[model samples]
Target: MSSRQGPVVHKFGGSVLADAAAFRRVSTIVHSEQQSGAFQHGALLVISACAGVTDRLLAIAQAAAAGKAEQAEQELQALEQQHLGLVTELGLDRGELQEYVRRLCAELAELCRGIAYLGELTLRTRDAVLGYGELLASAIVAELLRRELPVPVHLVDARRVLLTDYHFGNATPMIGESGYLLQKEGVTGALQRGEVVVTQGFIGATPSGIPTTLGRGGSDYSAAAFARALEARELQLWKDVPGICTADPRRFPEAQPVAEISYAELQELARFGSKVVHPHAISPAVSGEIPVRIRSVFAPQQPGTLVWHRRYDAPAQPLALAWRERCMAFRWYPKGNSPLAEMPEIVDTVRKVLELYVVAASQGSVLLVTGPSTGTLEELYGKVSFLPHQFVLACIVGNEPSRWTWEALELLRNSDAVSAVWTGVSPVALYVLLEESAAQSALAELHGWILHTHALQRLRL
Candidate 1:
């Protein structure tokens, strides 16, 4: 009666396995599938650390960098205790896991000492510190599976598998060879034998043997990469929520889940802060044309959002309603009076510096928004010899776009809060610039406009 046909790759987020009960639930979930013959080809689970672990690890890094040795030690102790508590709760005998936890704690203490003594936390060092969460999670889950499940489970350090350059943070995969190594190195055989293998996400070792991490939420991308590597039939992301809703359930009470959506649309939603899938994760899977499922741990039976490559030509309605937050729009002008000549360098500098997805760019202007870090933007603006006085960045996303700027100004809008009237640059989105205080009012006003405007109500789904 089981519907699952072949090998499946499942990723569990931090919230899904925060403790023993959650881990047990996961075990049961995996157990049921294998028993019912749902996991016919086998399964691979990528696990994240318990909720709040990464934040704590980050705090430890920050504190150590700031010379707060005492503070860092306190936080490190708390993390150790948390892991120890989980082990005790699971009622497992103190064995390999205990040793691993002890080793991790010692390494963390050394990391703190290094930070305090060196007085600088480089990107490489910080990444090494941050990789602990995924490692701990992977280890614990592997141990748990061994204790509870009937299948043979193997633990593989992704560092050895997902090899990459020494980028430290935001490392890109050395795909061609990494995929080959993983396939040849028993990944294919393990799945063939119906053994469940566990691997860490986000953290991978560089070619130079230093720890490197795939920026935040890199786990999802890692899972997608793995699926593509193995050519798995389905990639399931077990999240805390049911599926991608029409709107954020917190923001819109009447929000409904989207049963299925195209990868392109999902990418747009992710860029606009949908939280449905990592915007970066879509590219690889879409190119491969593999179906990615976003399911909820709470409702194991419900069909969640499915991400695939499909042309959405449905009736004029929004597939999902999403908006970006902490969004700031930069309005900049070239220092030179000549419009077209200086455009390339100006745009290139910003691109090199920020590495941002340009929502709008022109010969004399630019607009940029980042949901993550602002380092790139800061670097570009700081190093580029732009005529500083020519630029004025505004929070244009989600604001009422000015109607009069259509002809002369190159308006670039990326946020959903802007009404259709303000978005003159494109037919899809309206971009605006405003302060944080006015964002709510801007959203409300735009909501009214969007509900009534022919532009906003039209959905391409």
Candidate 2:
């Protein structure tokens, strides 16, 4: 019995990895899927750190780097107790489970101690410390899920198979090497025996074997990579939301759900600051032509958003909007006989150095969005500071850019709520920067004029 064919890839994020109840619920889900023959050859599960665990780990690492051993120790103890408590609730064998937990705790403590001794947090050391959360969480979750199923469950460390360059903080994976190692290592053999394999997401190893992490929010990309490597039938990402909505439902109560979207559109939405998906996650999915389904953990049976390469007669209009906060704008005033002529070139270089997204740019000014940062703000041509005004990104997905602006954006122009606008490279989405106070109203107006009304508009897929 060759079990059937290849593996099925399932990824769970921090949202469902919170506590003991969540773990049990996930185990029951696995049982139901297994009983339904969801795993043919085998199932490949990629899991993120427990909820709030990664943030805590980062805090501990930063504290240790700043010579705050007491604070770091307190965090370590709390995290250890949390994990042990989950295992206890699962009723796993206390002896071996406790020992495993103790070993991991000891390793984390030593890593923190080294950072404290050095009194400086280098990217490399930080990568090592951050990886522990996924490591410990994957193991605990795998153990609990294993106890819930009668089938064999194998734990595979992501670092062993997902090979990447030596980038310490944010590493890029080597696809060819990764696929080769995954096969040569026993993933195929384990699957052939109908065993479910579990692994940590967002963590990989360099060619020389030093641990590296795929920056924050890289777990989705990790799952996609494995989906391609394992030649999975489908890639399912379990998140908290129902799926990809027209706008973030939190902000717009009337935002509707999109049943299906192309990979390109989803990638653009993600790049434009959609927290529902990671920006880099679409690469492998597109390359392999795999269908990435976004399913909700709370309502598993509900038809969530499905991302594939199929498109019908649906014409693009305004589709979605994402809000990005705490942004900084850099502007270089044009000066006579000034050497700042290369301001544009400087923007290019700065983007490469920081890897932050350039929201909008004009002759002498540019807006950059960053997720929370610890380092001091880097200055450009102008003094760098946060804008006191509120702002949000309003993105409209449509094929005709000019028509979209003329039809749906007329209100924005008259309202003077717009500052700058840019379209994604593929033209699948139009990004408009808006004033914060008017964001809700502007979004509602756009949604009504463009989507709900559907006048002179093509239906969105």
Candidate 3:
């Protein structure tokens, strides 16, 4: 049932193809799709590690950098043996793959020795070392797939196509130029020839051709890039979760799958640490006007979530709800009439400290909401020794505003979460704050309020 629909990009996370068994599952999926004519246009599959591989690789890198060559060597050999064992389990002639493993192991050993001798592992070197996990996984998965399926598979060096800046561990991609190169170099033509292209995620080369690792969870972004390059009809991301949900299903129990979400909303959730998909993954599809689908690798039959440019046609109020934990609120009070003027400085100070934590932030005049802990914030600003004139902060967040945005503020004003709200600055934003213990109840109450007031419907009318 393979569709005659040209080419689509399918990116599988590390867990999806982690072990020999997972590889068998992947082969089943690919072959079934081809036989059923569902993948008429064929597919470009981007693979990550067998589960738990990257963490071990990272530990070895850390040990090597910390001058523990013996430990690093032992761990590196374990990884090599693990992959070699899986290759054999897949029933592939291990002779060729064994050679590949030897090469990969040799590279790791040489790099670790250098790290141990230098007694340091710089960010650049660490990124270079950690980039191999995805590389090896992609190669092995592609080879296994080719053996079981009729499709010709090409294992691409993502570095050859994905160009980036020199920022070692967290490089930013030159997306526009790279997309142009991919299109010009006939990525479409290659796919049209019925070849399954395989490439590593999370690693790209610099303009000078040096390997650079993308930011954390950058593999999703890499998949998005490939989708845009091929002008794909669909870009599918397979993950552990069944799809985007109204809340963390494990926590909410009653949380439901979101049938669809606008790219804007998905980005908002991602920025708030929704864990559904990388926030950056939505951008390529959004910009290219391509539909990106999030489906569960575990429950592939379910029609997950489709993220598109404009809002969905249906008038469904909100498709999902999300919660972020360990959220910190920074409360500030300025002395007397000057409080308004000092608000800017407080905002600036919060921003500077937050940059170090790599946490996302949203701000109101008197409070800043972030996902970092209070202790972490204190350590970041310890040198400044700047005491807040008066303030207290816990965690505060909710869904779209209810009729009680002002009422919520009033509740905070009269309660003990923080000091009196600053009146000098305009309350342009109505971001709420709550303690971790009360967040769920607060959200439920707010939802009830919105329903009774029909606030969203009223606003529309």
Candidate 4:
């Protein structure tokens, strides 16, 4: 739509809202921001399901689909108790909130019964069942914020505003239509009245009113969409980690936090394999030119990574490293008189329907990689002859990756850990293929070399 008005959109994932105490922490953060005059027009909070709830829901759905109604019901009861227990722990009024939770659970129970009767779990039905996690979580969060904040806090069903296509498991938002409905449905009115609006993420509805999800880890994308629609001043993604790091800090404890990153660099990192943000989350923000702050709920005082159009005063060093393990590489060789012109079409098809990453391509042959989650290999069995081998895909992300390509390649070659290396996949990344046994060592060496080289460049400057 138009440019930013004033409101800031805040998104919290499951890791940040793992418990009742975490909810209190979130409420406090929102309240502090409000007190600090951070919500001028108002603030919109987008929330994902609590930790592990979506997985539990998926299990219940599978059980029901397999005709194990009793087992599904038991799991449903356990889930209901978990939410109700959160209410109890929060000391929230057990009157209407508890009843509301019970009502949602009852609806889920009905869906379980339906699946059991049909002995099938269609993608649409699974999307419907999965959406309850967000519905339940947002409801609880709204109630907590209502009790904790002095300002009027309103809970809105995101499905009423975020209209999407018919893709049940991984729906795409219709931005223009969704924006119109969002303002038409009173979200703008509530914000104008200085009210805090909270909504569920990762779930939307078709134009005909069927529930759909934005796929796994789609909450970040949901928040970005809302931010773009509302023209928010900034989108703050609150996570468990301190901020986006040079590498996954848990795996590489020496990984340093990046103070700033460009949208292109962050997108490259996410596409390669960073878990801090979803791969599709950046485009909406980029379209709006809105800055996104990757913050940590645990370390609210520390300034996190600011992703924007450009990085001011930041060196053009490798920003981060991302890797996908358990990857399968496929190589296709050109037959006698056959030109490899069709190779691009095959790669496009595989990329569209699966998690395909092209490592290298040439006139004589083509090499591609797919992650462990892609199970559609049979579809390409006879179409293009491919020899599959296990490998790891590692990428070094930077603003000017070409500047450091030779250094990275030389390091990889010297280490003798990487099996192959390729650039030009994107302007911001360099990809290297490694055997599973060598991936860890190669990555460690690359990370250390990047840090050391950056330090040397800074000293020379």
Candidate 5:
């Protein structure tokens, strides 16, 4: 039987796994964690597809579907060089690293070949092709861990361990079903025996062994699932930035780091659009009431942000300001004037047709969506979806949100650039739908009022 001891699940993002040097740095971090007895039960490392690798794989698939053989081959060669370059830089034996490199290259080639022959891309085939990225990345990370770390490195193919339904591209793992396999397959046994396990995040397999992905940025979700399956002590996400900040530092220069946050606030920030962490990344941890830490890969010494299950009273000020760009807003009218009770059906219909999510909803009419939008969604929405404005979603995420919620809505309503403004969906955060062209200036003015003017006190430790 698997031990019930709490383990540590560490998820490393693509930005932290870009090159050979990054892998070395992670190895050092892992070493320190082990030496400090951080993983009371054991450790499991979940890896992403490395920086820019996913985009490249998707491009290769697109080129293949478009019958751009030369371009596809060119991208393939570049990808090969990039992985092989890492192997060389890490000073690994060519034959050893080639074992992984050759297999992945061959698999990608066959998938691309099929796409070119078919002249189209299906969601199933898309996931099958993209799954190779994380598999190859995990293989490299495992080898690096073996050579650099002081523990036994075991590569546990997540496709074999993580059981999921046939959702293909954005599949959901059956955690309970996976628990049985984990015990029977020695995943838990190995952890109990003190081997450090390395697995590819975001990739899973159906009962028939077909490959699938848990959407982009699902590595964190994968780690959380693994942690829940094992009843781990805590989940740690290693990122490039210091931690979860008031706002994205790149977009908001004055954004401050949040030392700690509650699970409720974190989920609100994620659903309303905060890239610091994925929306479903901590689901398992939240279910088990496990603590999670978002720490910096570059600055390991920093404590970073901690998320707990405890409730914190709403402070008078908002916690942080958040923003999501390229949001698409849509308004719909039913066959007859409908009551708000029709929301569930409308939401179901929209979900059936598009990959986008409803971020803000009011009177069962307007929906603020943010996700991969395509011509397919456009065609479906063209039926009754009118206005279909594009905007930037900016909000103040906090315990007790400021009166600025109404104030900002009024401010944006008066702005010549803001075509529409939304309020009341979430009490803690105010949602604004800005005209695409004027989004920047509108965000600047709002930020200046709420943040720069000291209206909301900075949320920190």
Candidate 6:
């Protein structure tokens, strides 16, 4: 592990590590990388829990808090059995790992009993319960890597180094302090000694060591945080898809993969409706100027999408389309003679409260798009009245969306399937609101138009 390059940070999600076979594949990938001299300076792996484990853990917590201690214990036993089954599938000796899993389960059972007796579930307690999924999953990964790689594999508890605030469910990482702790806790030293480090993602601790989670889908953020701390060469996120696609392949069957994209474009896509990468995951990478590669675990040889700081100078065309269903548009008519300057503050407040996706302000009215969860807007209730209209939001993401905004709007407006449409534009994207019933068909038509138009333009060039 003596080399001229910095270490590489790799993140494997639950979808890619579904079972023992998937874990085996992960080891093979690591082994291949090692053989190719990719880990000369060392490598850090951030792992999510196995598929469905987090949900199951949440259910167990709810059951225990509802005073069904016996049922919670039964579910916990089944979870234990699942891990043991994975151990059997991997053909590993059941002595040490089996005993360790049982001890962890015993502690979980005690917590469940406590919750049952108290009859309450606090976010703090729920976070503690949810974290066990990653703790258990990472242990299995560590063992698998130990058997596969010639170098030493060390399992470091992320809670020891990744410090966050007291926000129980969606805590923000204290990057400066966390970086200092990561170096102080021997993570750098272990890598320098030629050891491959494995750690659980999405879990960190407060100043007093109370466990906290970074919300769902936070593992990508966790991986980026570690990469920033380690100053790694690249941050690789292993997913189940080929790469970032023009649209979700499941919903839009005609969707095609994007070869490369700028950080700003990807950030907008993620923020709007894309699920390929977490919204906050790109910030640290941007700050550190690290290139992120989203690769498929199934097809390891193929070079997937590369997300970097550079922008391409190609002509304007839709790079990708992302949509959100079950959204609502809120229109507010301002009071008489209210200056337009005041709209910005109101929009900012609404965006923070509702996590709004699109906002448009005109002379008389302001419109915002958000999810149906309106109970959180108590503070803004009387300040501005809202007229709710159910709509699905579709965003067209590209480098220079302003260039094709008019053409794209006209295409949507003429479509027989599309009914009423409201539109907004940003530097990187154009947002369209469509009736829920016609959204699917309208998106399909728009996607087809984009592909056909781009192909014809290429021929002319």
Best by TM-score: 6
lDDT of 6 by residue, 1-461 (tens): 21225688899999988988899999899999988878877899999999999999999999999988778988999999998888778876554877777788888888888889899999999989999989888888988888889999989999999999999999888888888997898888888776799998999999999999999888998888888878778888999998988888888777777777778778778776688886476578657778788999999987788887766575677788888887866777777576576777778778777767777766577777777665677767777666545677887777677777787778877665443344445677777778787677888877887667667766988
TM-score of each: 0.72, 0.78, 0.77, 0.83, 0.75, 0.84
RMSD list, candidates in order: 7.4, 5.6, 6.1, 4.3, 5.9, 4.2
CA lDDT for candidate 2? 0.75
Error of 1 at 178 (Å): 1.7
What is candidate 5's CA lDDT for residue 430? 60
Q: Rate the local accuracy (lDDT) of all candidates.
A: 0.68, 0.75, 0.66, 0.84, 0.76, 0.82
Question: Model 2: clashing residue pairs?
Answer: 316-398, 390-436
Q: Name the better of 1 and 3 by TM-score.
A: 3
The digit string of per-residue lDDT tens for model 5 on 1-461 reads: 11335678889989898888898898889988888877557788999988999999999999999999789988988898888888888887555777679778987888899899999999889988887778888888888778776768788889888898898788888888787888887879878866788998988889899988888777888888888887787788999988887766788888767776777678777765677886477787778777788999888988888887754654544566666677665666545565456666666666666545444545545554654455466544554464546666666665555555666666566676665555456655565666667788887777666564343344353
Better of 3 and 6 by lDDT: 6
User: Candidate 3 at 200: error in angstroms?
Assistant: 0.8
Task: Name every residue pair that clashes in candidate 6.
Answer: none
lDDT of candidate 6 at residue 350, scale 0 to 100: 80
Task: Give the clash total for candidate 1.
Answer: 12
Model 4: per-residue Cα lDDT at residue 335: 64
Instruction: Estimate, for each residue in 145-248, the C-alpha lDDT of model 2 and write its tens digit.
Output: 77788899988999999998998888988887898988888887887677898998889999998999988887888898888877777788889888888777
Two-way lDDT contest, 5 vs 6, winner: 6
- In candidate 3 the C-alpha lDDT for residue 364 amounts to 33
Models sorted by TM-score, best on top: 6, 4, 2, 3, 5, 1
* Candidate 4: tens digits of C-alpha lDDT, residues 167-209: 8899988888888998999998888777899999999999999
Candidate 2 segments exceeding 4 Å error: 1-5, 309-317, 323-393, 399-426, 431-439, 449-461
Where model 1 places Cα greater than 4 Å from the true spot, the runs are: 1-6, 311-317, 324-461
**Cα lDDT over the full model 5:** 0.76
How are the candidates ranked when ordered by lDDT, highest leading? 4, 6, 5, 2, 1, 3
Candidate 5 stretches with Cα past 4 Å from truth are 1-5, 117-120, 271-273, 313-316, 323-394, 402-424, 430-461
